[model samples]
Target: MEIVIINSSPRKNGNTAQLCDAFIKGAMQTLPKPKVTTVFLNDLKFKGCQSCFACKLKDSKRYGKCSLNDELSPILSAVNKADCLVLASPIYLMDVNSSAKAFLERLCFSLGSYEVGYRSLAPKEVIVVTIYTMNTTIEYSPVGAMDNVDAFLGHIFSTPRRLCAYNTYQFQDYSKYVVDVFDETEKLKYRDKEFPKDLLRAYDLGRDIATRL
Candidate 1:
């Protein structure tokens, strides 16, 4: 089985990446371990979909495929063949980061058809999962931020399994930064008390997904 994780965080070793690592670790423990691949969007040179409509051209060879040839092109092809596709992102301004949004646009827009029922033209059905990490608490976080993305993916593939880590630790030394909105002590306390639980949950989620696959 092939599992591809698209990490959209600029910080490679940030909270979002840590959760992905935990998930990978859990998935690795399962028998007949799946081949896991991690793609960092921040490291890639790509942009959102261009409205070329090549994929929508009837009877065209490029139908149902993105024509933009760039760094993300190969990744998109891999995801098309992957058994599981994980979108891992750190929330920015109450929504997924730019990279995640752009990636989704390129991936989904091509696969989603302009048919009568707005059918999906994907090569095969792939499992989808979204992992969100944010600095805001659960109550304050944008709960519906990913609704549209999930709906689009659901139409193309299946309803995704969503996971979130809230109130993430943003900075190593909060005092070094000029931010004064959050109490550093409280943030540290929460990270110390709850972050492990979040990681554990991520691990369990990965294990469960692997077993089902």
Candidate 2:
């Protein structure tokens, strides 16, 4: 299966990446040797959607292509070819981080346009998901609203799957940072006792997607 993981966490080994790693491990264990491709959005050089009408130009073959010729071009191509695609990112403010949001915008413009009416460009049977990791607890109102972002993703990538991690680790060394909103002690306790379970769930989802492939 051609599984593509777009990781938007700027931290290389942050909580989001850990969850993604578990998913990849599970997918890798599947038959025929799963070819897992991971793209770290922070490592790429690209801008957000430019709102240009080039893709909408009449008789233009570039209707489904981002005009920018940068690092994200190939990644978008991978999304088009993917049998299963995962959009994983850390929640910033009330939604996905900037990099992730930008990627989605470009994808939206590339895959479909209002001029042509909205349409999906992904494989009909593609298994797609959006995984979110947040410092706030799952019950947090905005965090709960995170699933709303999937309205578009689900429309583009088929009915999607999701893996959410709440009360995620925020700092590698909490002592070095001036932060007092959350009790680090309780967060660590939760991570030690609960995060593994979330990872396990992620593993299961990965295995399931691979199995479908």
Candidate 3:
């Protein structure tokens, strides 16, 4: 199986990246020598869709490709070849970061239009998994955090399987900072106890997705 993971977290070893790493660990177990690729969105120099309509223009051969000759082109090419696409991102103010959102726009919008409805030029059978890490618990997350997005992406690929790690560790050393609101002890509890469960689930989910493919 070919899997491509786009990690949008700037923190290279943060919770979101850890989950992606765990997922890849289990996925490789399912398929020997799986072709897995991970792209950190922060490392790329790219921009949101410019609304150039090059993709939509008549006689344009780049219908399914973005014309911007930048860092995202190769990533999109990888997606074109991938059997499974995994998006790992830390929640920023209840949504994906700017890079993820921009990549998504180019990935989906350039290939198709909203009036024509959302679509992807990627394979029809490509599986999708999205992992979200946030500081708030699932119970407290805004209603729109993951809602509608599943279905929207489902329109482009398949109905995406999702993973969430809530109440995450936000700092390397809580004592170093003077943020008074969060109880460091309780944060440690969620970090040491709860977050591991999310990693385990992520591992299992990788295997599950791979097996399904």
Query: What RMSD, rounded to one decimal, does every model reach?
Result: 1.0, 1.8, 1.6
CA error at residue 203 for candidate 1, angstroms:
0.3
Please write out the lDDT profile of model 1 over residues 44-131, one tens digit for every residue: 9998999999999999999999999999999999999998888999999988999999999999999999999998988889998889
Sort by lDDT, best first.
Answer: 1, 3, 2
Model 2: per-residue Cα lDDT over 65-145, one tens digit each: 778778998998888888988999999988899999889888866666564557665545568877899888867836445
TM-score rank order: 1, 3, 2
The per-residue C-alpha lDDT of model 3 at residue 85 equals 94
Stretches of candidate 3 off by over 4 Å are: 114-120
Clashes of 2: 0
After best superposition, candidate 2 residue 54: deviation in angstroms?
A: 1.9
Clashes of each: 0, 0, 0
TM-score of each candidate structure, all chains considered together: 0.97, 0.93, 0.94
Candidate 2 positional error at 72, Å: 0.4
